[model samples]
Target chain A: MFWNKEIETLSRKKLEELQIDRLKKTVKKVYDKVPFYKNKFMETGIKPQDIQSLKDVTKLPFTTNDDLRANFPDGLVAVPKGQIIRLHTSSGTTGKPKALFFSKKDVDVAADQMARCLIMSGMTSEDILQNMMTYGLFTGALVMHYGAEKVGCLVIPAGPGNSERQISLMQDFGTTTLHITPSYALYLADIMESMGIDPIKDLKLKRAFVGSEPYTEETRKKIEALYDIDVYNSYGLSEMNGPGVGFECGEKHGMHLWEDNYLVEIIDPQTLLPVKEEGQVGELVLTSLNREAMPLLRYRTRDITSIIPGKCPCGRTHRRINRITGRSDDMFIIRGVNVFPQQIERILMSTQRVGKNYQIVLDALDDITVRVEISKDMFDGNMEHLVDLQKEITGKLKAEILVTPKVELLEPGSLPSFEGKAKRVIDKRKL
Target chain B: MDAIKQISIFARNNPGQIERITHILAEQKINILAITIASSGEFGVIKFLVDQCEKAYECLKSEGMTVSLNDVLAIKLTDKPGGLYKVAKILRERKVNIDNAYMFVQESRKQGYLMIEVKDINKSMELLKGEKLQYLKKKDCYPRTKKPVKSSQSGK
Candidate 1:
């Protein structure tokens, strides 16, 4: 079940040795080529030669999102323009989009790592993968497509949406796997139900790689039951070469983050220091050890998760990290209480009589309103039943988030359907 | 045949929502024989007694509206003051709680139908049978007047 058995199961001592070597090279290259890293190193008074051990990576200046934005286009590129083979940008819904460049070798290495992830997830050459992620400037679709092709699977480049065609392609080609966002997977299940196509009986899908949005384990279980397939949680961002960074093996416990390619760290957001103990909630910080075109050192990912403190039964020496709980930036305050959308998602998905889609609205008066769709089967044509369901959702949310949010029960398709990532929060409160 | 199939739609309690639902039914050529809307907070349930219940359900569902169909007793209401009270008393005497009810008059036939939603349809039907109340069949729920009663006259 391993794409590269030797590298995937590399011993901890050897993995660290390989990591230190790659880290040293990446630091030297970034300092020599990219002025941002050179200026950062000069200001910190840390030389590339100073990074002699893996622990020395802590001395490197952290790369924040603002730093990437301030640098803008090509300021972070380490290699020559001719050597760059591809480029991808972040989904910058707020301001300027951060860009990442890839050289020819960088593309190969990303594909290799993704292949390892897919193989570890039990995909083989015989499987047909229908990649439902958008194949554009975003790195999610293309990188996964390359990885699935590397695994020798017949990849159907079926980009997002056009649900009928996606299902027809699955039926015609006998696709056994899918690379989709968790929200889109749920949305697809809705589409299939309408089309009267039962995924368990009609299609040949055995597993799905769901990522690009922070979702709860409850949502994963819901998708799993809907399709009767194993949903492997994928963890990656465009800055870290899309979705090959971390992947769950067949064990389905936690994602086995590849240590040889990237060094992972968990640090408290407020203190900006490494957490005292493993499994404590902290912001994830990653450094690209093997990337050549854009070697990010101590890049603050701003994703909130913890490094699980045990060995996975999958036997990959590389440690696993829990699913990304929520982005540090996605957390919002209501009535002096911090709430992540995933917390609300967990409550809504686990509770009965609640549907798959929900929206959290923060109005001008600082009141929180949670809009949820009623489960199709739960409606018994009684108005009191709908009222009771709304109150139940409100009670459950209040018990979890400690805010008595006004729950609005909407019809199934009243909320906007997401073709890409589902935008669950709307903060209209005047600051 | 004892119970009439009623389609209920969950919609936002806003202006034009009924217009939208009626438009969708009109587009599908489905006739709304009798209709009632009950609002609860921000949303309301629009229940309909349509000429083609299954077609209406499929069309509304395909239009991506949250809709459901259930069996409810449809009894002919006598055109008198005690007509509603008579059925209410029967239900109260039988201890069958009425969840929802609506009445509409048939302009063409001078007949009226009272739709009643109770917990148990069969039990309520049995209770009304001893009272000699006439239950409307699914076919009887349709509007007797076709072509708006003006278009055909204009053609003549």
Candidate 2:
């Protein structure tokens, strides 16, 4: 039943051999077809033949986030424009959007990879999957749509927002699986509770695929408890065909990276050296093996995660990766303490009456001022309730980050609602 | 005391925001009968008693501004030096809290009206009724409604 039986179950020795072969082909193809890769290769003095083994991959130059953005639209496509059939743009929350091109062959291979991910994550032909990720230039919706269709799922292309309609569609269609982000899933759970609908009793959702942002273990547990469904972590990026790179197995442990499709590496962001010890946290770097329209080699994904060493009881030989902790670029130091926004988010979410949005502003003052939106229900009480909440959040933050922070309780919906990635932190010190 | 419809507009406390909304209302020939602005840091609230409450709220909302309409307290103030102080003194004695208030006189300058929001609407109205306070009905300011007032002489 494996989509690519031989590739998925390849032994470690054989998998590395396959990775080396694909890495050589990708390096050579990009060097000949794309000028950017060629110039980088010339500057680094590394030829395609120089990569004799997978270990030699360290010699290759890393294609980074800035490089992709600098090239912007249509700069990195190795194939002709006519050959490229689809394009997905990065969220570009802060700067210019980076374009990702996919040829028809690339699309098919991505679909195949996604289909394999779905089957492995307990999707069946009889299951009706509602793809709730926002559609259009966003890659989450369409990639999952094609993959679920490949698995013969009756797909409900319900885009994001309109939580009532999402729940209605679930009840009407008897949807069994969903493709959505972790935040949206929790948001939907909240909506369900407000609507007096018990999801476990009213819906048929058996499992979900949650990713595109780093979430905490608490959120995972809360979402699972809320919906009574198993949540599987799915990881991918726009540069690497989106949302099908690695997937969690039935073991509910680490996600197994599709080694035949991508060569994965965990490296220290500062030293840029691979972490030899498995399960050590580092930035995840990936090289697409099968992508044709745009072959990105040694592309720095910036996602922080660890390599989960050891065998999966699911019998899949593909190497596993731990859940993404945070982005390497997303970390900020406050009062000499390296604080991640996700860490703040985890603390905020675990507390009661906290809304879906919070803003951490680091300005001229060295300390951070966090404005947390108190859910609507809490605002009806006296001002003391808010002062207590502020104290509670401040105390928890101090306990979590080891620094006392200035916390303000804002009314719900005071801050901007993000349709894609939530922009929770604003480092105004730069501004 | 009559509660006149007052619309509160929530706008970012940035330059050109008040000018922006006033311009939009001016384009529609909507007269701002009374206005008061309150601000806290980067955002503020502007409450107005306009000629057309529904029209102004709809147009502003259609233009994508966060605006709301509430029937707040509106009463006529004697066009004299201690008129507002007298009303405030009586209300303070009764512990009738007024959340916010604004007053304006028409071009005639002989009569003025005050728009206010109180902690308890019924309590404030009851305590201020025996003062022979002149409460401005919505029609006095709007002139577009069909409701008839019990006494035209009540604007005493």
Candidate 3:
């Protein structure tokens, strides 16, 4: 029943051996082709020969987002420019976004891993998959789209939003699986509730793969309760060739990060040293073992999570990583869009008629409500003027953040003034 | 033929919201002459015709509520059967559509008032003017109270 039973259930010894072999090849390839990794290797005085077993991987330098930023466009690409088939950029708060390149082989391997993940989650070729993720420069959608297609599923590339149409498609096509963000899944549930469409009785939804944002188990349960389906937690980033990297099996314990493709290490953020003990929370560091386009060496994810201690009952030797707890940075995600508080501040400060104080409040439904105080002179005691001002602010914020947020105008000095650090965000989400 | 000014507030559709609005008005000693709520899924619009409309609007605004003011036709009814039917017949004959309508009846005075929110308040007003309809001004929305007679009190 497994997509690749031999690789999935390989013994620990054989898996480690495969990992070491792939690691040595990846280190040599990067050192030979990409000057960024080669220079780092030279600076550390560690050659490709320095890496022997999996434990010696620490000698190589760790790659951070800053390093990616320094080498902006294609400095880290390991293959020739003609070999790159796809490119995805990870958003940053300032400066140019970090670009990731993938070759045809890399794409195929990603889809293969995705197929393994889906098969582990009990998906079969007979299933109908309705992918709800946005398909664009973002890698989340296209990768899963390829994976489900590889499984011979009747794939409906129904992109995100438009709840009524989504429901009709589900009703007409009998969609069996979904790939959606947790927030959008909850939002669709609300829409279904208002339209009197019961999930269990009306739709044929069996399960979902929720990712692209860090969510708590409580939020997962709420989604499961609302949709009457199991939601598997997925972990991936653009540097790792998008989401087929790690996924929860049918056991629903933890996400089994595909160790065959990725060498994962948990390190303390302060010490920058690997956490020796399992089940201890730390920042996730991943190295691409099989990627050809742009293989990153010990790439720091900035995501905080831990490796599960015990063996999974699924008979797979790949270790599982716990659900992501928090981020090492202050950036927050809403509606699957990465947003920074500084970005909001930049918009509010530049916009005319905006007061000195503004607050970004995230509600339980994963909706963002930006509470902005109107300047003293701007509040002219006219409802039309106030409404127009609110609309203008919303348009500006949406243009910057790529997601429309509900804007609320308040009286001057309505928001509390902070002494030192102004807490710009008030997250009321139960998650 | 003055149209009544109504205050409308945009709020999340949840319990205790109407209570919150009414409590604010009650604390300000502003009486609600007429009220109606229209919900479109998660959020709804709460409309109100208050005794002191400007004061209530300003108060709600100061409380950081998303409130707006609009004009609604306040047609005086016949205070009996076929009262609304008469208006409806005239509206239908003239092709004047009502987006929303609610009634407020003062039993003591045998006076009935019908509030109709139309697409174009002035156009509807002009169309209904020649239909022998009397419109209630803003001040006329309040119920009239009679002074107690001294002779009746002494006899009692």
Which prediction has the highest TM-score against the true structure? 1
Flag regions of model 3 displaced more than 4 Å: A330-431, B1-156
Checking candidate 1 for backbone clashes, the offending pairs are none
Where does candidate 2 stray beyond 4 Å? A330-431, B1-156
Ranking by lDDT: 1, 3, 2
| Ten-residue stretch with the least lDDT total in model 1 chain B | B147-156
Decoy 2 TM-score against native: 0.59
On the 0 to 100 scale, the lDDT of residue A190 in model 3 is: 88
List per-candidate RMSD values in Å.
8.8, 12.8, 18.3
lDDT by residue (tens digit), candidate 3, A1-431? 68999999899899999999999999999999999888888897999998899999888899999999998888899888999999988888788888999999999999999999899999999999999999988899999999998988999999998889999999999999999988899899989989999998999999999987766577899999888898998988989989978889988998898898999899866667887688766789999999999999999998877799888999888999977756656567788766666567667878788787999999999899888776754543343455667788889989877889998766466589975456888898955
Kept native contacts, as fractions per model, are: 0.54, 0.00, 0.00
Estimate every model's Cα lDDT from 0 to 1: 0.86, 0.81, 0.83
Model 2 in CAPRI terms: which quality? incorrect
Docking class of 3: incorrect
Candidates 1 onward: DockQ, in order: 0.44, 0.03, 0.04
Consecutive 10-residue window with the lowest summed lDDT within model 2 chain A: A376-385
Give all TM-scores, in the order shown.
0.61, 0.59, 0.58
Say which prediction, candidate 1 or candidate 2, comes out ahead on TM-score: 1
Task: Find the 10 residues in a row with the least total lDDT in model 1 chain A.
Answer: A267-276
